[model samples]
Target: MDVRELRNCFGRFATGVTVVTWKTDDHEYNGITVNSFTSVSLDPALVLVSIDKKAKACQALENRPFVVNILASNQEPIAWQFAGRPQEKLTLEWEETEVGPKIAGAIATIECIPWNAYEGGDHILFVGEIKAFSYNDKDALMFFKGKFINN
Candidate 1:
């Protein structure tokens, strides 16, 4: 199948939007938009995120610790900011955890250390060992057919 067809097939599965952030040296970097996140194992409290192998964010995450910010429904603007949109500048407040950084307004935040990575198509699947986590009883930011939708 062609790439577009593959993308369409994958888009059939709805997903939540998240901004995965990480630090490189002293500089902080983040992926503005991602739908490739999932809980891996509850026994060990592991999570996984997939990023394009060629993306700068993925490159930055290599061998580095990171955090996943599960956005709230109202965080569409933040999602856009991370998705390379040229718009009014936004400054997000965040807190540091033992493993990584987390956005303050996120519905949930998980800090994790890099556990392992595997090559998959044009992307890399990163498994993380959860170090810290937080959650709020708020609606989640969702993605469908390339757009964020409130549910």
Candidate 2:
């Protein structure tokens, strides 16, 4: 199958939107919108996020602690912001944590340390060991079939 076909097949599965935030070696903040976040192991409290090899945040993730901000239904603009679409007059609300900076209004936040990274074709699969986590009762922002939707 072609790339478009594979992408369409993958898009059939609904996924929660997340913004993975990390600081570079120079203390520069970096964040990228990701939908490929998943829980890896329970005993070790591990999570995984796939980052495109070409993403700016991909290089910054090496050996860095990061926070995964699970976007709430009302945070679509925030998602788009980190996804490389800058909005005019947008002011971001950042909550500094021991692991990294997290979006202030996220429904859930997971703070993690770098555990391992593996080659995944065009993407890098980063496994993180969860150090802390919190969640609220808000609905999550979801993506399916190339569009955001409320469930």
Residue-wise C-alpha lDDT for candidate 1, range 19-47, written one tens digit per residue = 99876686665554788999999879999
User: How do all models score by TM-score?
Assistant: 0.92, 0.96
Model 2: residue 79 alpha-carbon error in angstroms: 0.6
Which model scores highest in lDDT? 2
C-alpha RMSD of each candidate structure in angstroms: 1.4, 1.1
Per model, state how many residue pairs clash: 1, 0
Best by TM-score: 2
lDDT to native, each model: 0.85, 0.92
Q: 1-151, model 2: which lDDT tens digit per residue?
A: 5999999999999999999998777877779999999999999999999999998788889889999999999888888989999977678898888888888989999999999999999999999999999999999999999999865
| After superposition, candidate 2 runs with Cα above 4 Å error | none
What local lDDT score does residue 61 receive in model 1, on the 0 to 100 scale? 86
Kindly give the stretch of ten consecutive residues in candidate 2 with the minimal lDDT sum: 21-30
Kindly provide the TM-score of model 2 when superposed on the true structure, using C-alpha atoms.
0.96
